[model samples]
Target: MAVASDKTTWTIALVGNPNTGKSTLFGALSGVAQKVGNYPGVTVEKKVGEVVHDGRRWLLVDLPGTYSLAPRSPDEMVTVDVLLGRQSDVAPPDVVVCVASAGNLSRNLYLVGQALELGRPVVVALTMNDLAEAEGTKVDAEGLSRSLGVPVVPIQARRGEGLEALKDAVESAGAAPPPTVPQVFPEPFRNEVDRLADVLNGRQLPRYLIERLLLDVGAHIEDRIGLAEPDRLQLRARIDEARKRLAEVGCKTPDVETTARYAWIARATEGVVTHAGETGSRFADRLDSVLTHKLWGSLILAAVMLLTFSAVFSWATVPMDWIDAGFEALGGLVEGALPEGPVRDLLVGGIIGGVGAVVIFLPQILILIGLLTILEECGYLARAAYLMDRIMVRVGLSGRSFIPLLSSFACAIPGVMATRVIENRRDRLTTILIAPLMSCSARLPVYTLMIGAFIPARAYLGGWLQLQGLTLLAMYLVGVVVAALAALILKRTFLRSATPVFLMEMPAYQWPSPIVVVRRMLDRGWDFLYNAGTIIFAVSVVMWGLLYYPRLSHEDLAPMVADRERAEARLEAAKAANDDAAAADAEDAVAAAENHIAGAQQRQSLLGRAGRLIEPLVKPLGWDWRIGSAALASFPAREVVVSTLGVIFDVGEDVEDEGEGRLSQALQSATWPDSGKPLFTIPVALSVMVFFALCAQCVSTLAVIWRETGSWTWPALSFAYMTALAYVGAFLTYQIGTWLGA
Candidate 1:
């Protein structure tokens, strides 16, 4: 399934309710032919996959998993637009495959009925048939197909079952006429919808949207249609009258739609679905009883988290070492093959070193994302939310926010994007504001570097617990704690709203598909590498330029060169005389002269000058000009901090493993010129780690926030508040650590 971008492709849209195996089906259908991008001016993520089936090209688009077609926010309205042929660049789906869980047919049919309203070719791909059969309930595909006036095929996407049948059904439906949509609402409601259509004459709004316009009260659709209608007063008056009539008839505006849709669904699915004598999910139920226990469940969750972080640290070490060595060799080769000049410096230090620093973390990213995808695919992740719901409620949020927050542990881009499921406007905003606080994979490189360099390797609990691992875990916890406090403050203050009740359907447990897991892992790893190559790549070059130029002339370096030459001569003479002590002293003098030249060159460079400019502000946090400069350079990309430090300390780009901390040793040996005191202590390292943990330094994340909220103000506010929070946190960390004599 690899169709090139051309005009020969027809688009097929997949729509379904949440937890209906929609994404799994998508993964099965698209395989590795898919690409992720954002839709223009909206929060929708465009996951388009190109496939060639039956000697023809088809583009499968997996829309957001939605429960209903009703539009509430501007974001939700994009769904309606895409299905109705109004969305830019996406032609109305030639065939719409409505994914339905066999075990939950009645509820799933609600969205199916709404899709039928589009009068487009429809096919139902029934998933989780095995799970349904296990519960002593089975769905008759032929019967359901007859009842809904469309083809229905049972499928188990995880196992590649019924995929050919599903594809055939979709192909057949595309060539056939549109399926029939049964009458849902009663006469009065239909009459109101018709009347609204008549009043908005020549507006050319689709008939379905007009129905939604009257159905979804106080929704964004009202504001959407009203903006262009010449007679806003007339439309509003008619809508008000329609709602009044609806109320008088005991059929409210929105609930009337729900009631009618479900009633029709029940009638259609009455005999199509049958219950069996035995329970299919009995074993699963028993397992849940133990897994959801208060004490055992919490401990298990902690253990699982511990295992995940530890694997990210320890399991990927060998691969990380291999990658680091490979980059080091490449840099060394480039240096050896080329003469020492600006071009060679840029290639060695800026490109290899800068990009290599980030690529070394690929193994860790793949491991983390793979683990997360497994947890989510196997259905344990949803249970984790159910387990954590009580705690989430105390902070004025429900468990739904936890999924996005947990995802942030991998990357904030998807984490922030996941907030679209949140229905409440203020609740969604609050979650968005704090999602960045969850330590993402970008921070992992920094955390690992700092912890490996500063934290001791003490073991406890029969060697199962290491101090370095605990320190890494503590950094993540700090983010969670601060996020909770931020949520509490936001909820109690201006963004206050009633804490929405937590409601979720626990999916049945199953073995995770290795194909899906690997595809997802590779996809995300590529995203990270692409980012490192592009934005981080460019930033590293600029940083090198800042630290490189305002070159030290021969006039300035001649004295240090002469001093080094004298020391070398003395060392040679001492060696000839067989004087070990004198030779050792001369070696120290030579090293000092070389250090003096490197330090002087860096001090007068642009980066050093800028670092000095902000030294006063960072002094309280125990950061000198060099550390401050690294922080400042990393504002666009947080992971660049490590590479920046490498350049500043003249340690090239390749940082070695824990056993031989090349950059780490350089940092420990650094000292302020005036005081001759060590620049990097444990407290200062802790402060730096804390600052990066809390800071909103990723420009891409802020841009995503702007896209999600549709207001630059929100992103601006997020940056301001997060930066302030980071400064105070770092200051407090350093102050307390020093006071405690750490």
Candidate 2:
């Protein structure tokens, strides 16, 4: 047996249609330890892992799952670039492991055939053999291998069956001669491709890319072809002529490829696959009927979402509270241990208070991601998207927009990047524009802070419903409602286009892999924590300085200091005499004098001055300078609003006996300077949450928009429109709520 041409390391690329146990096979091969990050210059995630077998290292690169090799968008083009070894940092695979579903051989083999045409060594790993057998279709691996002149191995990745044999087959195939390349285009179309290849002599386009170039209409692959201005015009003319000739011969450019491929597949699989049982699982069929039904499915989806949101509030409450208390104690410890200076303030006010505010919401973010992973694993997410398509279509979108929008609930950055899957430019831009309005995890801290503080924990319906959870749910719904309306208007006006037809392949329902779910949840959680430690940490430190700097002059502070000193003297005298009543009064007086100086110093800080300048603009939203300043400080990342609030309220330095809920307590006790009324009313909290909910406050999301759109115009437009909408929304919310005596 030849072992990959004597190379020390073999690159094995795993290509497959989705839901074919590709990821499962990857886990078994690489021990579920994969390095994940974005591919160079693209948003598509690159998942690669490695294993040492027989003293030879094999790098397993798991490509994204797709039905075809056609390159329509940048993300799809990434698949082609990797196969041809054009993607940076990824070596050409010695052998391509095309993971095919055993039961769905014909459809699964479609991508396998495409991979074969790439002129690389190809090995078919037939997965879901048990599912195939259950459906009464038995595939003879030897017979199929012989038919295609390639090795085929039937394996159950979940049970780890035939994995060793499959690995051996990959080794053998890598050293074996390349399999016969499958031709999917007709004779006339092939002639056109040949002619076009010769015409582009200056360009080193791959044979596979040439075929796709002629077949893929209105795709992004032309850029990958890299034709010069003159060459592009000449290439377009030649392509059009070739397409015309093929059309005259009744061989269409695109559909001809599909038709010819299936014809070849029909002959290749002859007498090899047998069916004895029903086509599919009866239980799954019946389950989908209820789950995908219009009326019942919609209700179930609503219930599922409500339960998910409810879990975020209920399940994450204890952990969040614990984290909050832990940070509070740490801050207090740092304060007492260090001297009163910038260094001590930096640790307590900047690090602990600022970063801790956002870190406290990690539990809720993790729970949400984990549950979404479960729903997606169990295959309900696809069905939910199918259900939402009806509403989406009315807004000039299809079910294809649902996944990206749903992803926004976790984080808008990924959600905005995911629009590459949609080929339509107008629809993609429209989706990206409305994506940040989906109330991503970045907004969760603001919502939790407001809802947990102001919304009463009243129970209804025999304790099934809680006011706080409902309030959280409403904030999310507000974002969704606004996104839908915005999408509708964008499609009708700026990004006007018809809703593209959505064709989805529903994956079989199965138990979610614990490894995948936990890894994903932890990955997202770590991202959250890492950001808190880095960008949010830096922002927090800067905010602390803005609030703490420009100390009161001696002339300005002498009177307040004297008052505090006098109160301290009285406290010492009363305590020495063991007069408990007088001691209590003196303690109150001392606290009052200290808080007064703290307030006076804050009013004179840099941030406070800026806040006062914008106070008039936001007064209609029931906000004072302090709230306006926090919003201004948090423009970089919406979650930083929590950190800003923590610094503003002197969270860890609350009244001596007040322990947990430090920020909330400070807000409740905060009052206007001129009037002693509370600063944060129910209406004010609602206004803040609603504003954060609707705002385009994340700088990262805007940058991604610029990258995806290849223009600064869209991001600028997004920021401008969303900011105005937020202000108006917040103003109305506060003004109306106050009128209703909220």
Candidate 3:
């Protein structure tokens, strides 16, 4: 008679514990069409994706995977808040799908049992059926379904099986009348919960769901009915007596609801599942032997990292060269077509040159993401974390802190957000403070220019090694070692205390799917372009304005230049008329005089006065004021450094014709006015690269870190430390190297 009346739309929340294939299922169901956003103001990742099944549409909300919804951290509280709809901002779900890994059903059931008692239309999706089969375990899906009063669907999401069955079950559950919310405890224990609830009512605590659960477990009564020394002795006797009574009735004292939930699950599992044979899969054994060993584990991790860096360095160059050539040609075309006026300078010299410098690093970003995807999907990443735990523990960092720190190597924002994985508040905060200290790929362009120009390509140690590449490698290693030592010192002095133990679930090794790896790589590339590109583009335009003003007009310089050039013919005749080249010398002197006269005319231009004003302070840094001015102008975007140098050296015309390819020529001819020495010597170049590597010079990184940390203090500290470290490090490198006659 009910006829499953037409509720075609279903609201499904995918709930599961951590490392339970929940995200994998979400990605599989949603494809690339999912939208990932934040939960209101918090950085907890929220994913909403849609799917159409059997002509019925379903909206899925992927909640953060947690071991239990105990509200331990802000991220963990998000799960409880969403489920209870207490946030006022988020909508409550119509149906709940609890995802469980069949391999670890006992631990996974802990979350599912809580969801079931919430009285929502629930379905349990058992994942990793293939792994279950290999373990010789056969779950009686129907029997388990009947026993729990909910449908149990066993499926391998990776293989795309049982999806139709899952959809049908979800549809049926949605059409059915909503089930009554079940009481979590049995009769006798229910009485104790009510007594505890009475005590909480008198205290006038907030009616949050977690507070209710805590009260139901007697924590509220303990706090309210405080006892002095003599009263405590009497209360302890009563508490022990009550515990004996609870055990007599097959109940537990400390956490009655938790004890009841586990007991129910244990009873439901009896005779419904079977364990087959031994689990000696040769591949797994061999992997564990090598990856879990103390010595070889770290060695393998080092080798994998070295290979990844090598790929990023070598493979990225081909596309980088292509991009470089295209920009150069475009700049030439813009200059040639726009008639050498102010308009041409803005488009060719200002905008194109400025933005092109930033865009050239895209190839490196893509390659790094691609390789990292492979490492993660193949499951070596988890093993790497386990192996590094030994070293991390010694440095006062948990093994879980490794992922957050490692993610910072790409960017600090995501890495800071990833600190949610570190459940310990102190450890998470410490990791966030040091994340920016890692040298991100944003520093790659600066390093490449210096290393390529100054570091010789010749080999050392009798031709057995390449000296140039090794120097570049050493720079990367310096960042890592420095970061580790900084973290150690911070934990010891400022946040000194006991370290939290690290716990992680390592997935079994498997051959990675190509589609998933590519999908992940493309996602990271898109994130970088959208997040970093906009900031860099705006900064480039601003830097261009600072360098482009005060252009010399052809008409304004005619009176002064015409007087000087009129004597050029007499000087040439003097040169031709001389017997021993004395006349030639006179003509050369006349040409030099006319050029000097023209330069004096330019000295009155707006840019000339600005350069002269800053000359005093910059002289000590081995930078004649012109180089100092360019450095100041290039602050918004580092790639503008070369172009600004071109403008200040009076080679702007040549660079506009050939693009950045002319940077070497421009720098070679630049000289300090006071000392007449080359401005960019080996020491200066190395010092400049070190500064870029250490500073939070990019505005985008600053903005993202601010948003992620939800405070100006952390991002400000990040910027201050990095900039101070950069300046001091660079100052020492330059002074010592030049003093040692480098």
Best by TM-score: 1
Candidate 2 lDDT for residue 483: 89
- RMSD (CA, angstroms), candidate 3: 6.3
Which structure among the candidates has the greatest lDDT? 2
Superposed by TM-score, candidate 2 places the C-alpha of residue 523 at a distance from the truth, in angstroms, of: 0.2
lDDT of each: 0.85, 0.87, 0.67
Q: Model 2, which residues run further than 4 Å from truth?
A: 1-3, 31-43, 130-138, 155-163, 183-192, 195-204, 219-223, 228-241, 566-586, 654-660
Query: Please, what are the lDDT tens digits per residue for candidate 2 over residues 659-741?
Result: 33778777888888778788899999999999999999999999989988889999999999999999999999999999999
Residue 704 displacement (Å), model 2: 1.1
Residue lDDT tens for model 1, 256-337: 8888888899889889888875655788788888778888888888888777777777778788778877878888899899
Per-residue lDDT of model 3, residues 18-107, tens digit only: 767788788788787698788986878888889887887677889988877556566767776677555555566667889988777877
Query: What is the Cα-based lDDT of residue 411 in candidate 2?
Result: 90
lDDT of 1 at 158: 84
| Positional deviation of residue 660's Cα in model 1 after best superposition, in angstroms | 2.1
Error of 1 at 649 (Å): 2.0
